[model samples]
Target: MQQVFVFLILACVSSPGTPKSVDVDTDDDVLTGLEKKTLELETQIAGLKTEICALEMKMKEERDSNQNQLKGVSANVSDTMKVVGDHTAALATLRLDIDSLIQSVNSPPPTPAPTDVSVCPGDDWVEHNGHCILFSSESVTWNTAKVRCMYYGAHLMVVDTEELNTFLKIRLRAPDGNSHYVGGIDFGQANWIWDSTNTEIGYTDWRISQPSNGRTEHCLVVCSGSTCQWNDVDCYGNKKYICQKAAVHG
Candidate 1:
């Protein structure tokens, strides 16, 4: 197209007989066509540039979206891992508890053996001649005193031998001249008997001219006088009593 335009320009310049006005009109028309073509080319270039910019924008947007999706997937994976780790820890703890429970169920409890008794009596009791004796501080009737002794799982002092009688004679002496009842009582029998054992009295330490055999003098006592001899007294006599029990083994 440029060559054709150049040839036309050359023919007009070389033809001496061509009208000047006609040649000027042809040059104007050719210049106008070239300008129109240039305008069209500029319009196409601008449209291409617009399309390329729009495509670039779309690509950029797609890239951003893909990056966001990748990030979301990573976060989800991280959360899933955390949950799995927590579950694993909980399972481990439960397993440990179950194992401990099994071990406890399989094991038997231990049994305690019996312990020996102590040789010495507890407080408020005295050990003498293989016996534990407690002297009552309060005086009461013979029956009441016997009941008191029974409350302690004991019996009133029983003089079964000469040695025990002598011991009682020496120990029964009170500073206030107070007498203590013994386990001896006649009840309705001719012979004195032990109230606790219901057996005949084996020994006696009666004072001089004592045991008048009075019907009312059924109960006996270790008289508080300096003599400390066994004396018959009324059954209802209020006198302190002695309590005796077997000594425990240590």
Candidate 2:
């Protein structure tokens, strides 16, 4: 363009007079070229901005998807726990019903007992009504009576029902014939516990105002002698005791 313009200028300089309009046309062309370059740059900038906006939206959607998955996992875990709890409760009710049916036919009805629903490691000490008796004669201290129960095949008796109490009264055969030493108490623990294995079972028959320790008592003893009073005496004392022998069930 410069060569062409210079050639035209020379041709004009050689002519009689040059035209002034040519200069104005050359300035207008330069302005038009600059405007085109600026417009192209603006288009490219707009395209980049659109791509950035799309990337941000994709990242947000992924985050939301992950959070929803975590929520589903949590809900599944809660449902599983609820199912286990329900089954456990149902099983307990079933055992109670069966025990009651068995007792009805057996005159001198067996007592209602809290489910020994568990398969305790030793001999399964069955509870009639609420009372359970041991069948051994292991010599132990006031405290030892409860301990040996776990080792030899029995737990200190824990009577949960009234029929169990009467049966125990007849079975213990105590010299005094009152409430005698039984296996129940935490002695030094926070809660009321059975002497044998310190079972923390909640339900029990404390003979109103008995087990007065407020958590201070450490042993359980029943009196079957003529006195018929239950007390928590020292565990070291030795006394003549009887264990319940199993009844023959047809």
Candidate 3:
């Protein structure tokens, strides 16, 4: 409207001497140029708006992709942590089982029933629970004591019954109580058996925590005193021992 009004004022101000028809044509040409410039500007503005929309869409897609990747990474980390937790729990349970096994191995059952017999063979040997037994007066290493008992046609004492175990405990008390070597041995196999019989024990009387798994303690002993019980000791150490033999008249 402003351009049209300006074109009308230019027509009115033209000198009477100029031709009206020529001025009208010049005004029309000026109006056409202005309209063309306006149209071109509107086209450029539309193009810029399209480019902005495209850029916004591309940015949103990238943002969505980044968010998905973050979620995947978080899930992977959670799975890894769960696996580590499970392994830790399993290791704890396994450790407990190993400890229980070790305790069971350290404590074993007793020996079998003794052979039937009526009378002991010698004056030095005494009859006890159907077996001939002799408690030595001299102290010696476990190996030496074993050899000495073998020389006497006997083996180290095998307390197969509670009665024998009690009797020996009392007998040792009578004269200067001390430890005595027995027939039990481990042999580093984690199994305690009678060295004399080469058999697994079926009857036993162990101390409060007897038969410990010491590396060098392969020999067994009857500990001294009223509260005496079986114990493991080093084979090379000196200690008194008991000898045993099956009696006659079975």
- Model 1 C-alpha lDDT per residue in residues 158-213, reported as the tens digit of each score: 97888887777676666655578878888745589988788988777788877876
lDDT for each candidate structure: 0.84, 0.60, 0.84
Work out the TM-score per prediction: 0.50, 0.36, 0.49
When summed lDDT is taken over every stretch of 10 residues in candidate 1, the lowest stretch is 112-121
RMSD in Å for model 2: 25.7
Q: Residue 34, candidate 1: how far off, in angstroms?
A: 99
Candidate 2's displacement at residue 212, Å, is: 3.3
Tens-place lDDT digits, model 2, residues 23-108: 77887898898888889988988998898889889988988988898899889989988998999899899999989878876768
Judge candidate 2 at residue 1 and give its lDDT: 97
lDDT of 2 at 189: 55
- Candidate 3 lDDT over 104-203, as tens digits, reads 8897866867765488877888987568888899989988998999998899988777778778777765443468998888897769888888899888
